[model samples]
Target: MTGLDPELADATGKMLTQAVAEVVGDDPPVEVEESVVLGNAAEVLLERSCGAELLVVGSRGHGGFSGALLGSVGQHCVQHARCPVVVVRGSVS
Candidate 1:
């Protein structure tokens, strides 16, 4: 949806499903649902955060400074989300 190529979107969806399955395994402790929504990433996440228990985001630190801890979207969510927010970063090897 939203300008994404059909094949790419299908592949992305499948990949996300597989990743979630791998994480949750056969019997997840909590309910799990997978969906794909195309829009401004931050705006979409904020809208969906209305009643979420927690919000988790990944930051590649690809913003202005390479050594920065959070990207713009993660920072925005941390400041504005109604629920608790967690920012996950790549492991320091």
Candidate 2:
């Protein structure tokens, strides 16, 4: 998540980048780049994804009914991203 708060955005970017790197591990590290923007998250992501091979986002489920499938930003990205968009939804056991 990016925008409004500089500290929050920086922390978020760092957290996400670190998480991705850890998930991929050092055996075959993945190439990752992060940008923090001060606008609509989905719009910024979509704009950035134009030159990307794929776009990945987590399902926040922030809108609609309580059990809604996707969040507003995720839904928008899936519909509009130029490249392939992957929405990862967390599962609770």
Task: Give the winner by TM-score.
Answer: 1
Let me know the TM-score candidate 1 reaches against the reference structure.
0.75
- Model 2 spans with C-alpha error above 4 angstroms: 1-10, 27-29, 61-67, 91-93
**lDDT of the structure predicted as candidate 2:** 0.77
For candidate 2, lDDT tens digit of each residue in 20-87?
77666655455666566778788889998898988888887555663466777888888999999988
Stretches > 4 Å off in candidate 1: 61-67, 91-93
TM-score of each: 0.75, 0.69
- In model 2, state the lDDT of residue 8: 85
Worst 10 residues of 2 by lDDT: 60-69
Residues 21-78, model 1: lDDT tens digits: 9878989998776767788888988887898887888887555774466877888888
- Which residue pairs clash within candidate 2? none
Alpha carbon lDDT of residue 71, candidate 2? 77
Question: Which pairs clash (backbone N, Cα, C closer than 3 Å) in model 1?
Answer: none
The deviation in Å at residue 18 for candidate 1 is 1.8
